[model samples]
Target: MQGEATGGTQTLADLQHWTWVLGRAQQMLLENGIHTMEAAPLSGWSDPSAFARASADFWTDTMKLWQRFLDPDSEGGAGEGEPAEHARDKRFRAPQWRQEPLFDFIRQSYFLIADHILKGVDALPGIDPRQKEQIRFATKSFVDAMSPSNFAATNPLVIERIMETRGENLLKGLQNMLSDMSKGQLTQTDANAFTLGENIAATPGKVVHRTPLYELIHYAPTTPTVAKTPLIIFPPWINRYYILDLSPEKSFVKWAVDQGLSVFVVSWKSADATMGGIGWDDYVEKGQIDAIDTVRNLLKVDSVSVIGYCVAGTALAATLAVLAARGEAAKVASATFFTAQVDFAHSGDLSLFVDDEQLAMIESLNTDGYLDGRFMAATFNLLRGRDLIWSYVTNNYLLGEEYAPFDLLHWNADVTNLPGQWHVDYLRDLYRDNLLVRPGAMRIAGVPIDLSSVKTPAYVQAGREDHIAPPESVWKMTHHLSGPLRFVLAGSGHIAGVVNPPDAQKYQFWTNPGETGSLEAFKVGAKETKGSWWPDWRAWIAAYSGEDVKANGARVPGRGNRKTYGDAPGSYVRQR
Candidate 1:
């Protein structure tokens, strides 16, 4: 169950076997300095007493688990909850995990030991907070890898499969592992299932503008009428912007256009060795500001509405801050942030890499002037290792099953490197020093970027379950922005929460129209709505956006003297 029906652990049932599987599927991912927490010495524990108590409890739980294995009907084996009732661990969902006394014991004992060790890790003192976080993250990875469900002997479902396939599954799994090794990356989705501009980034459009840093994609309008103020999205240079235009049914760009708006998206050029000299300022000037001004020229509109998803949202805040410093705050009529973090004080797991020591190590990753994209992709995968990693280990490698086509996973496997200096500047200034939200603490484009100085009307969306950009960190934007703002909480995490479409109606969002003292206070007073936040955003942005005109009007950006560079989902995105 480890979320992705990954098969068994290749008939081996030990830490080393699963570690090999984990390392195989997730090689080159943990090369970043943050994942390199030194194993804590067994003697030098910060809390010796706590460790002693935990060991005692672990043994007590182990003995009690044996009792429950002998008599599984008994209640409270270790501390609480039945094996099947685990809220997070889904690997033991098979009936054999519960019905077979030994498997049940293995499952319960595993959780007990994992929790015990983690509790001990949490209690470890005298370590740097960031180091502690790294240790915790590393510990969790080890614990997750060691789950019995990852082992063929312990996993009844896998044993059943091995028996059914006459051990063909293992052979097939080995071949699959070899294939992934050859590619030097795990195949998270069927490679042949989707194609760019064919099935995925299929929105009809042309690349109206291009820069070395990014391409401005002007999407074809769906409706006859278009907003007087065109909209441009500054997507995180971290991934493809096609996330907003993945497919017609799930495409936020298409949906926005149907609502009578001209939408332009920034397709950032993937960084490589040649792009090493580019820093944060290049993204601000050539990336955001250039794209904003280009859309304005094409549409002949003075003010353009903007949406920044994730890191781009952070960059948008900087762009706005720079504009405010230049007394050009009116350039952007409205701003929308999808899980962007301007304040890293409460940022999630990714923030663990912001330490001074880690910053240097990460900057050293610049092999040709940029950190490799594989580093970013792997780091994110580890953030949700159980689902993104170990599950695939069993399903694709050990279990010998091919994962079906998934647009999201395909996009995820698509890696993008960060400009070396830019990556260092972002983590050091914005994350390590927590400078972005502090007025004048950080300078961008030769100007002090003060988030509060940008008085544009804003709509901020955060995910309740987002780990990459925690709601608490995002909510701090409420206090940072000086403008009238609406904070909306979505039901899912980083990607799903933001990419949610209205038609699917798959997840819900919460709206607290007014400002609150904190994220928790906002949630307490928030009204939960059972649908996508797209419409809610449309209503907020529509007010700022001027009257709609015919989609074919001369005001629209076109194949005119502006020069149609190429089709949307341009050549840059096609760069590996």
Candidate 2:
């Protein structure tokens, strides 16, 4: 039997209510710098046939859905299987969506419309890649905003919650909304459930070195014997370093220390007006390279193994190039990149936001000031709106409940500001121009930096599903380095892939069996490993790590010249 809508008066009221709520979703996009002005689509069709096909498909799908709505039992849509989308899209899996014909139609119709818009954008022809990206972003933003799951009346879950709580859930939701309004971020996890040093960034260590822009933490060795060469980790400044050091089980920092390596984490300071003028050279010199020198000096070693995570890996590649230029490339014993992209040619969705118009707009907003972490976080959240934005909207606000404690999500929320000039210069030079891949096309610290010149052996890894740095983008690193290169792919997205520990036995990883020239070739010849890549990395890195030395009482080695500023996870990470 078909589900019926309420009376005419109730219908009108619902129309007004939903209009206001959806209008708020659009408002959110606006607040996050996705202007509705850009959301206005192209005025003319450059390719008539592509759009013609889209229109035909759209009509065909619409008619099919209409037929299904009229006679749900009719032989239509995979014949008794839930709409193919149900298995894939988690948003409409609720029983009420299928049990009620009216909602079933709404759910199916929304998917059809979303698919039409996105696929239409994909099919749109003759538009330059950049322009097409902008249009696609605009259309996708619109489509994501108009999702039936966003509105109260349209979302059966919200209706179910409202009924169960005797309408008190609505009031609670309103209160949550107002609180989020004041706080200026959508709540993803319980903030109070975590404390930085105690539970999350809890790896025991000391801030052995400090600079205006970063704090270098030296973790005590967990084993009785340690590697002769120290390990310096340069995590992307966009996020705090704690991501690699989440809980003991998930903490890559802890795991590495347990593997008999002396680990040092660089906790970047959240940039502000004073640091706004700081550029890429300043970060490479004072941040990445400085940490290297400090660790080398403390450990009294000629060189150290270095790891860069995410964009920090890009910076490290540049720094290594600079070192190669300065005849100091040998200072770094080995280089490892975690889901990092040195070549931006195949960089994923993140590259979409670094175009000229967007960069100019960002510059205009910055005015020689730092890019706020919240702004960056907002943009990142929009990249996966269904998981990061819409899901939270449904779960927290609509369901009128608090989010569960999640350390990774909390670390994700703890974003760091990008220095203004550094932010613009690199995005323009590396991301937009794709200069990092081209030898001598980019420079750092007054040196013509070339990645290939830095003939240091490298281990580059990418998450198979990473949106920020696609596997193809990371694969291009094999071409950039002059020395030995080992590339690997891990399952899951950016953070999960890298943070995975061996004990968990969670996700799988892949390694090229033989000579791997490209991502596809690697996949074709790859051998799959059953668990985390940490152990594999440990085995790979062991060759580079020097002969083991007896552990020096679980203390940092030879810090004669460097002062111990404080305990591990220093104050820089504590900044918003």
lDDT of 1 by residue, 1-576 (tens): 432233322222443343344333222322222133344353354444553465566657555655554454678643246544474466766666655544555666677667776786687667777678898999899888888778776677777787779889999989988988897787898888899999999888888888788888888887878888988898889888888888788888888878888888899999877888887788887789888887776677789999999999998889998998888888899999999989888788888766778877886777589888888888888888888888888788667886799898888888887788888888888777888888878778889877888899999999989989999999988888898898999999999998898878778999886657988888889999998989999989989998877788544456445887778789889998
Clashes of each: 5, 1
Best by lDDT: 2
Question: 211-286 in candidate 2: lDDT tens per residue?
Answer: 8989888898889889988899999999988999998889999999988998989988999889988887877998
Q: What is the C-alpha RMSD of each candidate to the true structure, in Å?
A: 5.9, 5.0
How does candidate 2 score on lDDT? 0.79
Give the clashing pairs for model 2. 205-568
lDDT of 2 at 160: 70
Clashing pairs in 1: 6-394, 6-395, 7-394, 7-395, 273-368
Q: After superposition, how far is residue 28 of candidate 1 from its true place, in Å?
A: 28
The reply for model 1, stretches above 4 Å from the true place, is 1-47, 72-88, 126-128, 555-559
Cα lDDT for residue 548, candidate 1: 72
